[model samples]
Target: MADAWLVVIDHQRIFADPASEWCAPRFAETAPVVARLATHFDDRVLLTRWLPGTNRNGSWRAYFDKWPFADRPDEDPFFDLVPTARDLTDRPTVDVTTFGKWGPELAAVTGQYPHLVLAGVATDCCVISTALAAADAGCTVTVISDACAGSSDENHAAALQVMGLYAPQITVLDSATVLA
Candidate 1:
């Protein structure tokens, strides 16, 4: 896998706020190809950031209180981070909160990259919940499907058909086969 680890889910600012309601013009058309794969894999990118508050209660405050302009502030203005991406100097932006970004700061930030090349936005919630929680933490995943973006298009084709029929740990490549 070439020391994998390029996550970028939840490309924030309320999912690129086009006035929310989970707007998705293919998430601004895959934000410039995920900002050119975070500038050609700058130390293998990682850029998650979805910090809506309200104590983030069960099921994330019942899934943002069913949107419709749900405003759970205290600081989460969509937790911005999509200004062309690539800012984490030596790759270090984690800031998690469930919805598939399963704990321990993404296992202490990719603990040494066994594989995880997922991409961004609401593909059935936090890019299918962090590619099925990094394939149940055994790692090795690759959901890139045009750099990802959902909340429509049939919830992004039913979250890539449940991460290809019930996530056998993931492998739904595209986006030029994980940026070649």
Candidate 2:
């Protein structure tokens, strides 16, 4: 597993804090599972944060318009990593404007074709976005279901099912299965 990098995605205040409209209901419960999964990655971990692009070009402009609260600058407290997850910062970290974290910024950190173990919040969104893009880019991807949270339980399962369709390129499993 040394070659595989554990990428913890968007475990931010906006998605984890109950007061936020974008909060993921299971985010609190998923944090511990993510922490435990990080231990298995050795020192190979990449923590990713989502921030609104300053430009907000193309469809992104409309995307942000629909969710105005998240349109703030990256430094906003709304984008901070969940308190309990800050301890996992011993490894490398990156801030991304895009929903998918598998572009040049990530490729530079994980290498050209990396094997990624993904865990984090909003399975129906960021987790799914990262998984497909990484897999499509020829990086082997594994998403830990229990270590991720979504807007709703149904969305989480639906996202998992969608990602599972990618099969050999992208595999979805629970934390226990991976830990075992």
Candidate 3:
């Protein structure tokens, strides 16, 4: 798809908050790359914020329970998007309540777009999850390597390999490769 939509995941206040359960210092590192891409392709960009919620008594709760700090109201902030990413969302930003964005929340927000160029924080989690989902939905998915930050470098590399092997539908490329 020549006309691809850029998708940015998470990069929210909760994740960006140094006090949050899954905060990553490297999230700030991708700011420049994300800003450049958004500037170049403003109309096509779609940013997503993770709306934190309770898993309740479900199986998912078990995982979240282990990290109860994330569920605290204080951990979820009003301005969750990184300042850099927040500026980019002036074009369009979707509030996704779930980990995987394949549901109606994103469908109602995204309207129609064939290509999904994904970037943002926690590559092994939200970024990886959304990439596979978007690719399965028939969109051409490409993960902007440099514009994405994982909780750790090893996790980021592992996520890339996992996505490459399992989600062959996705194309893994660095930000410069696509932005240039």
Q: What's the candidate order when arranged by decreasing lDDT?
A: 2, 3, 1
Q: Give the candidate number with the greatest TM-score.
A: 2
For residues 1-180, what per-residue lDDT tens digits would candidate 1 score against the true structure?
567767787677677788776667678888888777766667767787766545656666666667636555635545667667646435656775556775578767677335787788888888787777667767778787888888778888888888987555787877776566
Model 3: colliding residue pairs: 12-80, 13-80
> Which regions of candidate 2 are displaced past 4 Å?
none
Residue 5 error, candidate 1, Å: 1.3
Number of backbone clashes in candidate 2: 0
| Model 3 bad stretches (over 4 Å) | 73-75, 109-113, 166-168
lDDT of each: 0.72, 0.89, 0.74
Which candidate number would show the highest lDDT if scored against the true structure? Answer: 2
List pairs with backbone clashes in candidate 2. none
The C-alpha TM-scores of every prediction are: 0.30, 0.96, 0.87
Q: Backbone clash tally for model 1? A: 1
